[model samples]
Target: MNEALVRATIPQDLVKVLGVEPRTDSQAEAFTRSFLKNGIQPNSRTDLNSMLSHKAVVLGYARPKKDKSKTKSKRAKGLNARQKRAMKIFHIKPEHQRYELFLPLHELWRQYIIDLCNGLKPSCSPQFVQQKLLKADFHGAILTVIRSKCPSHVGTTGILVQEFKHIFKIITKEDRLKVIPKRNSVFAVEVNGFVSHIYGSRFEQRASERSAKKFKTRGTIDL
Candidate 1:
């Protein structure tokens, strides 16, 4: 069946519903002439729907119109350049790094750890204490480097000011900030007479990551 015949066979009601104007004999003849001139065949059977769709595309009605109000712009993930630069510029001032200023913070941390360890009861299982301490936040806790590869870091006690992935920044009793690497270092904290030792080498993770991570127990750990 020819395209012209197919168009002619379409019902009048469908042509009205599709909002299409029926092509007259003169228009069809002109279209056939144009197709032949362009080296195309007009013998293919094209349905009314296909014809209307083609007409819509030619008139630019088929392309979807974007509504700015309905389309939401996606927020970029993580810190931007400005935030990174600002972080570099803003740091704890030396004058404000007094250990006395963080005494209240240390008290709060002591209370928090005591509560986290279920009051640090004598009957509490070692496994439970270990699990809680593994995920515990050490910010504001008084950490004393009991043992370390660096002899100078040994016995250095201070309030933990900040914790990084591989470093611990602490404000010493002398009101100085000491950057202690977590590699091959051991820190101890006493809470209500219950002393807990933190092996830094095994805890080389951010607080957020340590909270979610599962640690496997080995017979021996290096350092």
Candidate 2:
């Protein structure tokens, strides 16, 4: 808890492990007290040594003590700050929510989407946009963003899903050929290929097609 208490309690030999050879017990105690005053915890001698060694590694005073055996080497490898940051993949910042779920798009939101499309995230993956969408809990993400940024807007699952699809170019050009006429022109909409009338068209169209095929099968068997 207290630096004075920690120094008084930790062994003089372990304090020397910090690379400061003590001329006396008091010197060793002072040396140990100088660093890790705030972090020091009351623990057993072995645990105290391990904690100090870890602190030394973090401050660049020492590399983690290595072992010759292969198994021990793997176990000793601890992730530093840089490694932890590297582990975090691409994520959209909250500012990107300036793009409303509906029309009248903002330039900032549009530019952010463009950045994602162009592989502007950390790595060179062309599919980062698709990955971002797939990894997200679609409905939950929409609700979260809307609640946090656009609290006044009453957005639905269909509206958010369509907006996401238009932004990410999830719909194929061939699929658009038949339905484009049922909706506004691509350029007319803030998000290209987004037609208010055709928002839920894909789902309804697929369901109808499946129902028609099932009906035809029944008709054939009856005959």
Question: Highest lDDT among the candidates is held by which one?
Answer: 1
Clashing pairs in 1: none
Q: In candidate 1, what are the lDDT values of residues 1-223, reduced to their tens digit? A: 7878856556887988888887788997687656544543457555544554464423235668899876786775888758977887436887898999999999999899889998989999667777788888999999999999999999999999889899999999999999999999999988788777899988899899988987776454332
lDDT of 2 by residue, 1-223 (tens): 8878856654677876876443687875666766656455656244556666674535546568666675554555788757866884323343433335322323444454445446344453434443332222222121111121223322222123223222311222122101121111111122222111222222223322423433222211210
TM per candidate = 0.67, 0.16
Model 1 lDDT on a 0 to 1 scale: 0.82
Question: How many residue pairs of model 1 clash at the backbone?
Answer: 0
List candidate 1 stretches off by more than 4 Å: 1-72, 80-86, 217-223
Top TM-score model: 1
lDDT of 2: 0.34
Task: Estimate every model's Cα lDDT from 0 to 1.
Answer: 0.82, 0.34
